[model samples]
Target: MGVRLNGRTAIVTGASRGLGRAIALALAAQGAAVAVAARTERVWNDKLPGTIGDTVADIEAAGGRAVAIRADLTDRDDLPRLVEQARAAFGPVTLLVNNAAFTAPGRPPRPGATRAAAGPPTTAAPRADWPPFVGTPVHAFRRHFEIAVFAAYELMQLVVPDMIDAGGGAIVNISSVASRIPGAGPYRDFSGGVLPGYGGSKAALEHLTESAAYELQRRNIAVNALSPSQAMLTPGLSYYRTDFDDVGSEEDFAEAVVRLALVDPQTVTGRTIGHRQVLDGSFDPFGP
Candidate 1:
């Protein structure tokens, strides 16, 4: 089951790894020329695997068209250059995936540090001594919102003109279920690392998605927010020893995004979709 994306040009931010990388490869596999953008071009951090170069290499090796662009999403000024670089390599970007996120602040807890310890614990926990809202620094919240919300908005603005000129296009904002369900719920029921800053940013992104989709519909462009129904065992989550049994596949997100990208703007705009809905064939982006 493959979607046809021939003759389309796409720009996928955070394509160096995780969900972004998976989406980039899926788009390219369907014949879209992809611009894989991320901060890491090489394996500078041994702990973190994947890079823009690595993504491009895999795409090219698999006979898909792609190019690597090193761009930091945190720096607002660098966004236009990212789109420009992508356009230079693959023409105007009609498919934009805002997938990069600032993750420095909301990491899982450490190992065995007691409540009396000066610092925080080593593992994930919702304990009083853990780094929750009270323990989290203000700067961390600001940084996360800036990257996850501001950056995604700016990137969408950069690509709209091109998409309009091209007669139509799609923008997929990769959000998380946390945006809707915050605090200790089914997904957040884990031990530690339950910060609302990241989830708040994603919530903002989803709102932006709906707003953009409504305004852009007149121009034949479709903008939507999509999230995995469950947590994914990406490198980051895996670091905390997150069990994959209860999580969904990264490909679930990738496939749903590709499907959304191919849909007509009139039928599927101004909505936040989920991977489970997409898989079950009940994905109604226009539904209330």
Candidate 2:
């Protein structure tokens, strides 16, 4: 029981694969009753090891408790349903991982700019055309924001009351290292689709964490943004094909989250922590 979460309940979004999948399994392994949610029917199959279904099986097999649900975390309708589902399957959800995100599709900020023709260029990966923010499409930006930041806000808004009703809860927002380095833009290869909404939304998500933490502190709810890792070696990062040598394995990130979930609520609210610090124990993952 070093950091076990026995009898506690956790809901992890984006649990179909990648980081979301890892978070769910790790929590289950720690004795928390977990609900793995994502839009994959495969979660029901029990064949794959890291799938939502497999996480549930792993939890039960280890004498822990868990369940898997197929839901698109980005869809607006899915939030309340997800919360209710957890309440029904386990009890009040005391832990939440706001992990799903979408990149808005638009022409990247870098492309065909003359020596003196551009203002600000895109700074990060998939370094397409580094156009100024003014040049980026409004709609594409909105789409990314909806999925990355807005959806997360919605989930938090819905879940907090329940956590209050249940006495307390912990909220972890799975953010990227990009947030820490404001200059990096989207991945160039993956930017072909678009992520205006994604980047813009995450920028907003930082504020949401602040607001959520400030207002809910009185209620004993903890809100924190965890910069899990760079895109060094994660499957989630491979989806973008962006390279950053500092990225850690999903297990590395998961371990930090588990430690945070078990800590006291007051110590961890509103921190923007990176895997470097969170995993290396520079900062107490559970402390505010």
| Best by the lDDT measure | 1
lDDT of 1 by residue, 1-288 (tens): 134999899999888888989999999989999999887655433345788889999999999999888787777768999899889988988999998886532322123433333222334342233247886788877877888899898999999999999999999998887676545455735544555777889999999998999899999999888888888877655544454468888877898888889878898887888878977878655576
State every prediction's TM-score relative to the real structure: 0.85, 0.75
List runs of model 2 lying over 4 Å from the truth.
1-3, 43-51, 103-140, 180-196, 284-288
lDDT value, residue 6 of candidate 2: 77
lDDT of candidate model 2 versus the reference: 0.68
In the predicted model 1, the residue pairs found to clash are 109-122, 109-123, 110-122, 110-123, 111-122, 124-191, 124-192, 125-191, 125-192
lDDT for each residue of candidate 2 in 203-288, tens digit (9 for 90 to 100): 67877888888888779888877776555444334435544555567888888788767556567788777766866768764554
lDDT of candidate 1 at residue 179, scale 0 to 100: 77
Give candidate 1 misplaced runs (Cα > 4 Å).
Answer: 1-3, 104-131, 183-193
Candidate 2 TM-score versus the reference = 0.75
